[model samples]
Target: MTANATLSPADAVQGQLEAYNAQDLDAFCAFYADDAELGAYGGETHTRGLAAIRERHAKLFADFPQNHARLLHRAVVGAHVVDHEHVTRAPGGEVFEVCAIYSFAGGKIARVDFVK
Candidate 1:
């Protein structure tokens, strides 16, 4: 893992956020499980596995170019970690706030629910 940080889910989430803000794709994916799932808060869309997750992120990183998420708040309860973030898009796009709920399994992120 690129984070080289703690193994706990909380720490992993923190490191993942750091990696995301840094736009380090490898580092960002390192904190996630191979079978990780990413979905929206309303279940409008979802990426069902690691490969899909990577593909989706690759496109996003390439598309946004300057995209980044800044953590405004964090809350942890058991294996669940929630982050409130301010996201800035690239190419002079707008900034929006979102809440991300993360679930961990086997020391890696197993699922993510993005509440926009």
Candidate 2:
């Protein structure tokens, strides 16, 4: 795992966003579960498992080299973390807000579902 100044899940995800803004896919993907699933918002694309997720992110990173995600709000219930976030596509200066529900296990995200 990559070490950072983050202490909570929110902080960890924020750190991930920092890595993404830097176009460091390695550090960004490290925040997810080994068998993690990423469901695309309002789309039929769903990437399951680490390898698939990596592939999906690879394309995303290539498409938007300066993407940065920020958490606008969060609600935590036990190990379940829900975050409302705004992701900025720096190249286009466009922002999109999405809500994501994450299930954490052993301090790692085991699942993620994005809701528009």
lDDT of model 2 at position 19: 71
Candidate 2 Cα deviation (angstroms), residue 25: 1.2
Model 2: per-residue Cα lDDT over 37-110, one tens digit each? 77755555487887887787889889887777787898888777788988987756888998988776656666
Ten-residue region with minimum lDDT total, candidate 1:
1-10
Give TM per candidate: 0.89, 0.77
Question: What does candidate 2 score on TM?
Answer: 0.77
**CA lDDT scores, all candidates in order:** 0.85, 0.74
Candidate 1 structure quality by residue, lDDT tens digits, 1-116: 35433477778898888887777888888888889999898685478888898888888888887898888999999999999999999656888999999998887899999998
Least well predicted 10-residue stretch by lDDT in candidate 2: 1-10
